[model samples]
Target: MTGLTDLFELHHDGALAENYPRLPGLLAELTAEELVRAGHLLSRVDADEVLAAQPDQRAVTTVITGPGTLDGLVAPMTAETARHGLLLRPVLAGFDSYVFVLSGDDPEIARHQPDLVLCVLDPSMITRELAVPWEAEDAERVLAEKLDLLEQLVAGFTARSDATLVLNTFPLPHELSAALVDRRSRARLSIAWHEAEVRLLRLAGEHPSVVVIDLDSLVAEGIPLTEPRMSVYAGAYLSEELLVRYAREAGHVARQITGLTKKCLVLDLDQTLWDGILAEDGPDGIAVGGGGRGDAFQAFQRVVKQIGSRGVLLAAVSKNEAEDVRAAFRAHPGMPLSEDDFVRITANWDPKHQNLTELAEALNIGVDSFVFADDSPYECGLVRRGLPGTAVVGLTEEPAWHPRDLLRDNWFTVTELTGEDRTRGVKYKQEVARKTFLSTFSSIEDYLRELDVTVHLGVATAAQAGRVAQMSLRTNQFNLTTHRLQHQDVTRLLADEDSIVFTIASRDRFGDNGIVGAVFYRRDGELAWIDNFLLSCRVFSRGIEQACLAAVLDHAFATGVHEMRAIYRPSLKNAVVREFYPRYGFTTHDHDDERTVFRHDLALPVEIPKHVRFTGEIERPVR
Candidate 1:
């Protein structure tokens, strides 16, 4: 049985290898025999034993190629030895767990159920065989065969009532046999095979119950197989240190895929469980400070904070004065969180539904990803009723039990947390700052001047692609034609001669609002049509919109384009920007219930505010 020490070692090795390539070389240089020993050590470590010690309830079934399959060996072993006393039920009832080897092609295995079926394909049949190169005709034949097999598998899974199928794609070839060791030729073949595997994984994910785990990425990272020292499985004649690090990664992934957890938690403060308002209690009297009830709440806050650090976004939705909460956060010496911790906060008198809506908007996350936690049953019920998609946890019986109960709900496990997840809260706070700055200025020009705004007008880059796609999806109020695009679509637009996509980023004394706006345009000879135009609401009232319009039009006029046309397609949330085009000197040429099209002559220079400085040089495409 592996302990926490083994798990920590595995995680450290995986992180170091993936993030720092130099670490692998350094470890390899230490000793050739030491690298092999490390690989052997990692392979022997049982990840399920470490998981059992944790307070997790989910069944984690590991499949190994043997006579007794996961059901016969792993399940009973987990149930008997697990530290958390969790029910580790076998997915397969009959025979030793090793029966899964024969059941891979068995129809009964799909019907006669388990919570998780660990299917281990025969290595000899799947991996040991050389991949046949697909000529044009062979490619067609292979696709047809795989598609037919996939359809049958999908149907078999759909017929099952209780089981959720998780399919592991075939692992990468490990043999470095003399026949296969032509390095240069093997690299090209490997790339082709990898692409084929990706397509297979995508096909598997098309089924609801099936989650296709990319076994190749796992193998690339490292996985241990039992074979002779000179054999491909021994972690010799390859990057043994790198492979060991990757095997640990594979183990971590195996645990995560089977773990039961939620994505995010929504919190509320005040009388729910706390003794008094944070603002009034001055942090010390607030139940989260130190001892007694305060100790429990403090423990809860610490737990919640830890969850946030692990990719679960923490949002606050309370019916208190915003200023009071802000003051409490600033001055309360015992306060666990500052204003920066929460991704979104509704510390106003707004209804819980409204707060939740704002919270979802601010985070740019789906409502389903949110799990609302409040000590008051009424508030929880209100949220549950108003936002059906959101998972609202009620603190009905014991208010102090809320934190543990929330944790029991398993609402904070996610497979990956990108860079966007860590900085989301800070981004929202910057948005708040931008909004506050906009409110202080009486006129658009004044707002622009106070901002000391610098508008970057350079051509779009690959880095801005994600932000551009996100703005298109999330922006509602100012979006003219709500044409939601993926990152790839944005990339394509930037490359096309007929279309243009430009980004707008602003920075003032307050802070940097990174890439808050985007505009997409289509050129038709003498006229340029605005396909989509939207800005982050954070930069609203800042005259940045006007600056963007002025800049684009200036480019068009210089390029000998005579006319520019824009359309306003009304949406439920875009009432604020209905007359946006007209205000910018565009004459209303057409209107309908659905859309209002406006046109302006590019020959006439639109009035430009003096404060907004366009710094970057424009790269005009050659005719």
Candidate 2:
């Protein structure tokens, strides 16, 4: 087998650029050490060259700052970035200068604007600073002081930079707390240490762009907390193995920040969700919850259910009779998930890729948002070839590893949970009811009127920053400009006196789709610029989008703004809305291959759709 380094070297010519898309799959097959070597090989090539080769791909800059020897992390992190299809321009902070770099004291590092920053901190950094004799009061005070100083540094950095900060809860070493033989004394130190970790976790809640990765949980996941030999020999606190795992997590965060998160999980029913084929073993005979492999399969189902409970749509695709599969789900008492949990279930002998296409169409989302899992290698390979954009999780023979493999890439990770996220399954179910109701009406207008659709539009409050940011990230089909913003970015817009962040929430006879649309606009003198407009794909083809825009135009006219200019950026998925501005009585002021600027005269009198009732307040009396 040829190593990744050899492959890179073999394709060192322009062939590397041609093979860029294939690199991720090849890198995925390598071990951690091999991946790191591949990263080094990739680093030798020019980033601009690789990025320019793929003109359509978006690139993000990242800065990695920490307190120890972090040179070993660059290669692995680069490999991870390559796997994510990002051109990483990484700037590593000097050893023991995490504070200096983040505090803006290091001018060289502070000047570069990055999209994401990962701050890696280990317990040893704080432990080394503790009192020599380990006085309880002294330890507590030092921990508090260090945490406060770190908080100040983070605040200073965020105030100056727009990058999303990634922090981690430090894992406490046993020696530091267990130094005292007495359990009572040990407990005190442990509590104090954990309290400090809690403070670190709170930063994510306080700063919208800041997210804390639970390193403690990662440690619990079997990565060694520390390697004394590495610390003593090379002044490296975190083990190389730990860095490999941490790189994977940080990669996920980078992908999320850049709007590359997978929205759905497609599963193979037989031997994947459960232990055996439903057609052969029957629901009663299929091993599911008693013990051993059955218990593992049940646990995996529970994991899938939990994932579905939080926004990620679940679907099952199997090569079996539809009736038998539905009957199996009905008869299996140990099944953690009912058919209702799934957004779609296709049980037939169709190719999984074709079924996935149908599922994507039914859900009105891109297949790139999907992650497919199956136990058979042949099936996984078929889907991989057929739907290259879809992520495939090939289940191993060991049932115990099923859940772990499914989540290895953090495909459905979100920075924060919202009210909408908690009720996504219920909302999808409501959508089914709405679709069923749609068939009963003769005309689209009559159907919309009968559904009693009402859109509630308002200037967004501070609390809706998360949902607005989520819409900015997840919405692509009906999105104009496809501008990705973080929660802090949305909050900043809300706080700006010259800006209006309008949120659109819809409710009908079925249910309320919470905050499904956001329109970001700013006033410049007498002219208003709509920076971006995003409407959830779930609410497309309805009059809600037009109604929301009509209300916005009315609000601008009421505020005495004569003209509104909106931007539309062309993207692969957002081309469906290419004429959205023109369709709404806006004429193109200027246009090129990249974007079109459309201008609408507010005096033209925009009218909301009669079928859709729009009720909202738009702040008036502008300059």
Candidate 3:
């Protein structure tokens, strides 16, 4: 069976096998069923021991249940406890832990309350009679009602303690045919069941105290059901070899989902590393192109390249001449990565901080996404002061351990790294091209006139949804009100009659800044309230924000809206835009310590900035 070994070999070398020789032997002896049972046993044993041993640091706790147990009350209750245990494991792993089954109706797991309660349920425990047919519309309704009861149980558990509650969805079984006996419509029923599970999971995720564990996706990959041994019990009956491998893989994935740190290191070239400058070294003369001491820099570059490939943005901020660097990228055969690998390159002799700021602007990414790597401590300190959000790492550390250290420091653990991440460097290069083209123009109008800047305003598409949600999370400076929104929240607002969320895309002489800006607003009679207005800092000073606002206000006025209301909510990082609303003709209507409200009468058409030219027809919500 193609198992964890194959997946591991694809990304990692034989390091895992070499490190843990006993693991293979242990795995080979146990059947898949036995391994699953053992895992549960180990979890329970570990939880009891860890909780009993360390009580002071136990901030969170969880309890989980294995599949196919149907003792009714006991099974559901145990499942709830297990769910909490699993969800809070990452949070409490460094601290204390707890797990216990309640014997009586005294549903609270223990006399002392936990800081958090995590409840998990196995779909197999719910009676076949209770299971709703996948085709029935009432299936969701029934599931919701059941979930409500489960939530209430969790509430009861956390009643004595100030613990938050979390409910996890049941993982769907792997075997399709066993669950769907109706042979003719098995595929349709399976699809429906999967959809139903997702809906239930989403509902759980939306709960105040719930973090839905997407275990269905976690376990469903690999281990095909075509094999008879694997087919039984939803293809969970794997050979002993597969079971042990699967556990380790699952554990790793779990760790990724819960791990902290999500930024990357960007390096600088030249005297930053070796004794001599690369521009003077002329490729072959450089210290990095050979054996001995050169190997360290080569190893560092290899590590940086690997990190970049794994979704971390690798950027270059150097003081050397740009042409010299370009030559090194093209001519140097020893180089691990080329010019195309870097997301942003600022090689001018300008202030390092200014270069970083320009890099941030060009990438449409926040300064927080950056971790500057330079050999000079002076430069690192300067950047730290200029861009406080950015993290800086020096090259003074051990040369041999630098690669591993860099990876450890700038680790970006994620369940899935999307396609956008892979092409990010290329995209930033295109942005650089755009900026260069803009530089050639004598005036802003000339640039806009020459480059056909088309602003396609549309309701948020699925592709654009992630970017919108990301903007809410990462954007600060230009965000009118820094209200972070989830993807579902954005979707709901877009669908609501009282609200409108629009994204702006620009394709000009350079390239496309795909959905670079998003604005969300709602109307109240004649007053149009601005909920959110944020533009990518990359497209700043391009008059794109002005154009977007103009289009929105024009649309609002034409639709019979007399006034537009906006709020300037101050944040520690957004001090640059303290007077943003006032500058845009908004009069101060109300003020408090926390927030300032401004209103503008939409009587006249606001002058569009000369640098921006709107096109391709805008469709706005009419009041």
- Return the top candidate by lDDT: 2
Please provide, for model 2 over 1-623, each residue's C-alpha lDDT reduced to its tens digit, 9 standing for 90 to 100: 25475566656654676567676566755777787788887766667777667665666677888877888778888888888766678888887888887887788876777888888988767777876777666677878998999899899988878899888888888777777778887777778889999999999888878888888888897888778988878878898888888888888888898888888899998888888877887777888899989999999999999999888889989999999888888888888988989977899989989999988877777888889999999998888778877888999989899988998899999878889988886776677677778889889988887888889888899888888998898787888998899888888888899999999999989888888898888998889998998998888888988888887887888777889999999886788999888988999999887889999987565567888887888632232
Instruction: Please write out the lDDT profile of model 1 over residues 145-255, one tens digit for every residue.
Output: 544555565565444322334444554445522235467555654555555567666754454344455555545534443234523433232233323333233333333
For model 3, residues 1-623, the per-residue Cα lDDT tens digits are 23234323422542331222122223222344444443443333334444444332112243322332212112222222222122224222110122223111434444333433333344433323344444333333545565555545544543333334434445444453365566655565455556656765665434423345554543455533133443244422223333333333333223222222334457778644333576666655776648876778777778778877865777888888888778777777777878778866667889998888777766666776677777777897688667755656666645666664455322454423445455555556777777778789888778767766667666676556556766665566677777665444565676788888888777666766666678887888888988778876656656677778878887788777889988777765567777877777889999996689898897655666664557634644443
TM-score of each: 0.50, 0.92, 0.55
To one decimal, what is the Cα RMSD in angstroms of model 1 from the true structure? 18.5
| Error at 218, model 3, angstroms | 18
The better candidate by TM-score, 1 or 2, is 2
Q: What TM-score, to 2 decimals, does candidate 1 have? A: 0.50
Error of 1 at 545 (Å): 0.8
Candidate 1 worst ten-residue window by lDDT: 20-29
Candidate 3 residue pairs that clash: 62-84, 62-85, 63-81, 63-82, 63-83, 63-85, 64-82, 84-118, 165-209
Alpha carbon lDDT of each predicted model: 0.56, 0.83, 0.56
Worst 10 residues of 2 by lDDT: 614-623
